[model samples]
Target: MQETPLCLRVGHFLPYSMSDLNTTDFTNPSTFILVGIPGLEAAHIWISIPFCAMYVIAVLGNFSILFIVRREPSLHGPMFYFLCMLAVTDLVMSTTTIPKMLSIFWFNSREISFSACLTQMYFIHCFSTMESGILVAMAFDRYVAICNPRRHSTILTNSVVAKIGLAVVLRSGILALPYPFLTRRWPYCRTNIIPHFCCGHIAVVKLACADIRINSYYGQFDLFSVIGMDVFFIAMSYTQILRAIFCLPTKDARLKTFGTCISHVCTILVLYIPELFFSLMYRFGHNVPLHFLVLIPSVFHPVPPVLHPIIYGVRTKQIRGRLLQLFTHKEI
Candidate 1:
């Protein structure tokens, strides 16, 4: 089998003889190189300091939330259960990308196996999508608690959370299957240097030699059906909750109710802003910004994980008191 110099670069595919395709072995590329921060070669080391710190904080903060939620009996209600699940999802989501990103920046270990890259892409997208569903679930939790206080317990009981959690996991896992499957079938006849730290779906897919119109269409369809729909429902839930809050006679009651939602709202903003920014950038055109290359997969990916725990811990009385007890106890 003769290897040809045919590769797919941005905006152009290098030409080669049909004979080369016939003669070449056509086996998939075994590995891909991760080029972290395309042109920022000199600053990779400088970037590592804050990137590493962000990852550590994400892990510790989410874990602390999980531990506090699990140990406290009063916090075992539907709201805290959803929160604990969010912490777990956040831990997995950031940890999936950040460690490898740090390795790429600090140690220059940028090689990833083809199969392993697909696996990472699957879980990364899966947990991210799952978090959206979890947010909607948390919103429903708030909706019921505020909009219909007496039935809140009955509606979001242990059985209900378990079912909602299972549905969220299944939805993400199922939808995440197509991209990696489609990617595996695309022919990679060129240099396999990925421009990001981790194997994002579009990042890896663009390297293919085949026509990717269907892939692009399906990607848009998936995003709208999954993320777009989640956003719609979350907005609807909040709207209903706001209407319910306004109908209350007392200002103190309204303030208290709105306060409960502050943490969730912050979590929503942190998760979606950077993600939607990149999505829109990629949707309109091909060229991605340098900061999106350098910052998103490393820094912003961990922001929700780190921020969610802090926001919830401080805003929610039960979680705040429990966490303070653990930290401030003289016996410890």
Candidate 2:
């Protein structure tokens, strides 16, 4: 027989067994589990039930808010415009991941195809950025309303609000585009198991065959940039709001300004603080606790959207009144 080249022999090299051929030699697949809840599958059944319930509430609440904003003449202002955008964002955000989560939980099919996983991850990032953008826009609206009430009518007019809404979607879309593209570029050399209920940044990145240094850099930069920018803008807005409130000649103005922003403050803290902790934990404390995996991202995912309408509805009299009136009225 003709002498075979060393490269050809090396290429055909088999390491002792058929199991080696079947198994992914690059990395271990069994270590990462796809359990959404720890301890008990029974408990997970219960937890997923509530999680699905929360998604329903999120959908209904956000739809109600959207309907109220669109139908009401008096609510055709910047505040309600931002509110409508938020409602849409929340609806999309919940819908993006909840269906997959519920499907997996009920049917026990945790196998997400490459395309499906990437698509889910894309929307998760998209709406998340949109929500952040909406919040920032809301803060600016508040700042204008309190800091310069005279110009609120002129500055935050319908056209202005529409422009801002467009900008929000555009910016978010641009920022989140890199995630899916970059994610798809890297080949997966091992198991495609994704922890948690959805395709998240961390869960997807862990499977990359190539060096993910750029992914990590982008992740850090994007997280801090988005979060930091939001905090900075919100703080500046609130400072102006507080200044306007404190310097006010009337108690009603001060109280109204303070009260209006109270809802926003609550929403911001609830959404961001957990995210900050989780970002830090994921960046540095990834090795510490398994519970942190469930704890960190879960707080930001379904909870923020579910809680947004509730907090604003309970805290803001106008929004609450409109929402109540919409449901209480029967068909004549």
Candidate 3:
């Protein structure tokens, strides 16, 4: 082996300290190596700049949304509540991938333990799935508010919102449990290198020695079915919403509903468009460069959390007024 440089920053990827001997053998558990920016190691420093910016903004943006929503009583409606949930899931998804991603780009640390990788894989998938689930719920909230304005409050009470939140958490978390558990049982006899900064389901499966047809099929099925259902419901809700708006007697009413939906449409595009593209590319595009491929989804991962409140909170009259009023009063 070539003598490593003094700045050879290759170390196991984790917050805690572990010996260099940590590996898959009788002495230690399995370790999957993360290949960070192969053939373009020179650009890792420049690559992390925007990624770190996005991560910090996402965390701060989501935290601020949670705080502002809790502080103001006027923002206690179901739509905002579901927006809060979306912010939370975005935070989880970003956090699951970004810190280690930054580590790989900054310090060149890319080794991750098997158990830790599995946990990371679980949460990364889980929270993303949860985001879509919450979006569907948000669509239901909008549908009720627009279609049956009189019964909106009656149908979507605080209890109902809480239930929807719980259901989103459970569905995303529980259904994703099997993939990690089963993947662990497989014999990963091939080289342990994962060609990404973080643990992804398809990446991890590709490293296994045993047949992964079951896991692949199950993952794809679960991905499409659970997330597909959410997409279907969201589409139907919007369709009904449009129907209700058109049935109104005045063009002003239709415009009003259109204005209300702008933020939601933007949010949906930010959350799903990149995600769907990532899923499809992983399934079919073997020729794609890992550096470019990873960059695409990683860039979009934080867009929703960082932009949601800016779009929804800043544009919504009540929330904007309250935020401005708070700042003005505090300045005194």
Candidate 4:
């Protein structure tokens, strides 16, 4: 008998046959396979346990912040409003990737449609940009409350806060608009395997067979323009805040004023430190192991969401008091 064709023999074992792999539609693949983390497939189950716990904490903590902020009148201030925005951004950011990521890890369901992959990529970047903008707003709130206390309320009026929130949303949406379009325009003739839990813009773009100079350049430009500008503004705001804090005559007064900013500083550090590391690793750490490269984004994305509410809840007096009251009331 004649030997069976390789495509026919393997057709039952794979989604695509050997022949189909060679003839896959370059410009429009039906689906892309996410390999989670390369070289760590055997440990996906173990890896997912902490991730799942973090996701649960992130969801509950952010929701609790939102609910407490909404219900408690004492927490109604410009800073708290900004905190609400931050909570919502964190919730959406984590939600956008974690569920699908869990599905991949638990069920080995890694195939994501091209359009769906692009949508995930867009939401991840958009919310990340929004989170950075929200942090800047929080820093500005702290600066005004400290350095310009006389006009803090007037400067960050309800109307002004609403306008700032609108601006952040519009800026993030517009800046992130180009990412999906840029990635889509390229023809992806290479293998459809993306070695990540979610569709990262650079990860997806690298799979394209065409030259991706524009994609790479735009990614750099977008990262620097948004994150760089936000960081600069936050630093300037804090510098002014510190100067104002030191001008207070009493040591206790200076400490009291500075205490107000500790939470914001902590929040900024948690967000930017990991983000900077992830960006640098991707751009320059060519010698870094593939698993490390994949794990960084996985850790950074959900970690801030899990930590932000805890930081705010514990550090902000009104939030902490209200939380204690809430739990105590439950006990009674």
Instruction: Give the lowest summed-lDDT range of ten residues in model 3.
Output: 1-10
The number of residue pairs in model 3 that clash at the backbone is: 0
Order of all candidates by lDDT, from best down to worst?
A: 4, 1, 3, 2
Per-residue lDDT of model 3, residues 237-305, tens digit only = 999999998898899978988788888888888878777888888766656755566667666666777
Each model's total of backbone clashes: 0, 0, 0, 0
On residues 84-162, what C-alpha lDDT tens digit does candidate 2 reach at each position? 8888888888888877767766876556666677777788877877888889999999999888889999998778888
lDDT of 3 at 211: 77
Choose the strongest candidate by TM-score: 4
What TM-score against the true fold does each predicted structure earn? Answer: 0.90, 0.86, 0.88, 0.92
Candidates 1 and 4, the one with greater lDDT: 4
* Local distance difference test scores for all models: 0.79, 0.73, 0.77, 0.84
Cα displacement (Å) at residue 135, model 1:
0.1
lDDT of 4 by residue, 100-173 (tens): 98998899898899999999999988999999999999989998998889999889999999999999999999
Q: Name the candidate that leads on lDDT.
A: 4
lDDT tens string, model 1, 1-332? Answer: 11122123311221223243332344487887777766565688998888788778888888998898778788889998899889989989888888888888788887899999999989987998999999989988988998999998888889999999999999999988987898899888655767677898877777677787777788888877877898899999999999998998999989988988888898888878777776666555445554465455556667788888889888888878877789898332
- What root-mean-square deviation over C-alphas does model 4 reach? 5.8
